[model samples]
Target: MTADLDHPRRGGLWHHPEFRRLWIGESISQFGSTISQLALPLVAILIVQASTFEVGLLVMFEMAAFLLVGLPAGAWVDRMRFRSVLILNDVLRALALASVPLAQWLGVLGMEQLYVVALLVGVCTVFFDVAYQSFLPQLVEREQLVEANAKLQASESVMQISGPSVGGLLIQVLTAPYAVLLDAFSFLWSASWVAAIRTRPAKPERRPDRNLRREIGEGLRFVVGNPLLRPIALCTGAANLFGSMATAVFYVLLARELSLSPGLIGLLGSTSAIGGLAGSFVARRFAERVGQGPAIWISSLAMAPFGFVAPFVQRDWTLALLAFAQGAMWLCVVVYNITQVSFRQGLCPPALLGRMNATMRFLVWGTMPVGGFLGGLLGSMIGVRQTLLVVAVGGALSFLPVFLSPLRRMRELPSYAATV
Candidate 1:
């Protein structure tokens, strides 16, 4: 059966059982993942005593899966049950993360193991994220896409607010390696919730002539050929590329150069989530007021400048400056994400949802590893602060693609058929 895309239920998404379950699981997973985000790099730096480039390499390994198997994974996912994929990936990630704590307890944890774990977890995450995005269109009506994404983004923001603080405290007590165990448990919890989802999406029809390469090409062509999607992809990819570069050594800058404590750094990270939470609340309204298309570019354009503030941060006001910059950056990011994601969900055909989402992710997120490597290289060459300045300037200009596209004229997005 097709989803009820045109008619939204009367009450908010909380009234829907399946969506609620998905939200809860995702919420728990997001919280745990946030902790790992801080804890993992800290493990490399503190426990293994990794250098600046090594830390960046850790980031690279974590996101490198997108560049490797991203295209084929999408074609593969299009032929499977999204919920099953989500559950399996969650379990795999949990297992991978659990290995870190086990190795640490045995006094055998090393940088190499960390790299392996990052790569494994990254591979699992790539699958989970693609399936997760594809699954959403089946879970909720298209009309509820914005509201649903907003609520989900809000939960993620809340996790961002609290997760790092908790992670920092755990690191103080249990140490960074042990702290990752919490994330492992969180993944299992997420898997259970996802498995419990009752509304199963009908499987896509398989054709006898199915070919992986052709399917992959179709996804790529659809994304690159579309007017709205093309610019969106370009804008997001460019933004993420430079954003990754700036953030590659951000913790290093804070902990080593700025000499900030983990607790203070966590606190500053939590402060940034405040803007994400606010943006979650405001994203739907902002889109309605400014028009969805305008909201996409305007939000990005407005927030891009705050990134420049990072290079100027000092010890005395480091907390304030970091919080301000991250807060402003997250605010726009959430709004843009909510608006754009909902549009894409509404635009793509159900048959192409998996491939479309995967292609979009591959295009947008694939730049992360490249940027991470560049960030590390630049940090080592010029200095962390200098790299931040360059990243900021480049990121600010990334919005030019969306601003110049036909998306600027339309108040609302059209479906794939209409666009053609």
Candidate 2:
């Protein structure tokens, strides 16, 4: 069944009370996440004086849960209330983050504790993300999906631009472990906002005969069997894989090879957020003008090649070139993400929404760790620049899957039933 677009809340999404609550909570949570992203590594590096290898392991553990429990988590989320899941996960993450400061103050903060926090937070995040995506369709009209997504992405981009700087300042003042307190507080604030939202759609009826394995298979089949979803998944998965490959050594090349200062590197990093912000603002208009299908593939195909500029960047005007390249790449990514994710949410049946989102995330995001490993290995053998070149070229070609599919010709997405 399609969502009712003529509902009283059908005006501007910003004016929708429940949507505003969700958006505010999400924006705050994302900002906190950015803070923690910086704080986590800093806690290990600055506070505990962790070895380089130990820091790498910390990063690995943080993301490892996605590969471990990603698929099953979706099936589980499908069985529960999305809002409750969201609230509970936020509390869990807040409590998890809170532990670090407590440990630090108690003089018990250690690498082991850091590892545990990373693992716990990662697991909770997996559930939260699955439910978050699944819950959005229930909150807004089908017609508002694109606009809603654009607003959310734009806010997230704004946070990305500013969060790290805020994080750095907090770290300098409060120290790394204490800086994590900001993220803990942010999660609590997010939970409060989420708890205040009262306009949730009714939960899907539960069946007594539900089988986890079968439900997971159904989700997998839906994504793999649908012609439109399949190519999109392949294209996304490829892009993520190669993007991770480049990311593994991206900073090393800048800091070690290019001899850029930390401040300059941070500035360059922030440029992507500017591009992302612009993309978020423009995505809805671009889709309206060019058609969502063409916008999806064309954005990726035309802009991803700029990624090639990274490996060749030098200390001169090339640095600006690098910033532009990263910015352009992110611009395309945010635009494509807003359009495609809205399509997925609008296209999937409510019963399958959680599982579908989870399965796709599994296929797409699950590649990062593997790609990181491969990139590390390739960098060791062929060197960082060559590995980056490989990533740039491969990422550029990732769009081919979607470009060659029926999506290349369509101007608008078809209904879920029609696709099936």
Candidate 3:
């Protein structure tokens, strides 16, 4: 049975039947998402003629969902069946994305309409993300999580590398709204794919206290009280804050400061896929040798050095190489996430997974807007180079959470489960 199941299909999790289906669906969705990432901004720039402040406002609107919806939605998701939630999220996102193109075709595209779509889609994304993270542990055995996450990361990495290039092409060939149509299709595909996954029915428990404040508190307590989760949360949150800060100025670096064309930037960013793919492969080995905890620490520390190099690139080619390094740096993040997520999932009682996942993300992503706002502010005041240097310095400081926590000494994913 093991031999037949393990037959190398695509040289990794692609060989597994269930994982293959999930991967294909997710990949398609990612491609579409990539198109929208490019198309949406172009729509704002070319169609709406939005100003920098307007663009920043739009970004804030999009990200606001994470801050506003993540915790509550996570609490709700823990009490409900996750599969249906994921399916609904995809369906809703598809409809939301479709509205943009449809409205454009009807000659009624407006900033109001665009903002609404961004806001709604972001809300949907929060729910989908919370549900998806909680759902993974049920799909695979505890032992195979590293491989599973690696495959998932590889898929996302591929999309990250290729999605923008493809999106850019579609935008060039078919205008921004039409380019978004591709992503709408991808969401539909994800919805259908999610509907096909089969898992054992969860043993329903009494719904926790219905008071909104109490439920939210319960979720927060679960995350804050967990031995392993608390430190991971703090470390990841700080890292996310720093990364968001730097990303806020990346486009300015490419377009306004570096004087690079969109096509070149897209191509340069594409090279990051190789680094992600490489990092995914390396992750499994690292976990085996040093353990998930150490892997997380190493990956976290490595990211700071890699990020600092981008501002120093002197030439276009060098910039691209640095971008590849950045991609690899991000890949390390993916590996850390996979390991940590799996460990968390395996250790936590399934009943608490949703809230735990949500709580962690809420705290981590909650800082993103602050980071982005600071990024833009600092970039404007001090210059993009100085802003990034600051981000790098702050990002390096993020490792302090892990260093101070028990993760500093952890050698591997604990063989005997340690409850949160």
* Top-TM-score candidate index: 1
Counted clashes in each candidate structure: 0, 0, 1
Order the numbered candidates by TM-score, best leading. 1, 2, 3
Provide the overall lDDT of each model, using Cα atoms, as 2-decimal numbers: 0.89, 0.84, 0.75
Tell me, by lDDT, which candidate is best: 1
Cα displacement (Å) at residue 273, model 2:
0.8
lDDT of 2: 0.84
Worst 10 residues of 3 by lDDT: 1-10
Residue pairs in collision within model 2: none
Write the residue-wise lDDT of candidate 3 on 298-367 in tens digits.
7777777777786777655687668767776777787777677777777667767788778888898877
Higher-scoring candidate on lDDT, 1 or 3: 1
Off by over 4 Å in 2: 1-11, 42-57, 101-113, 254-264, 314-317, 380-382, 417-420
On residues 271-389, what C-alpha lDDT tens digit does candidate 1 reach at each position?
88989999999999998898988999999899887988888898876658778879988999999999999899889988888899889989999999999899988898889999999
Arranged by lDDT, best first = 1, 2, 3
Clashes of 3: 1
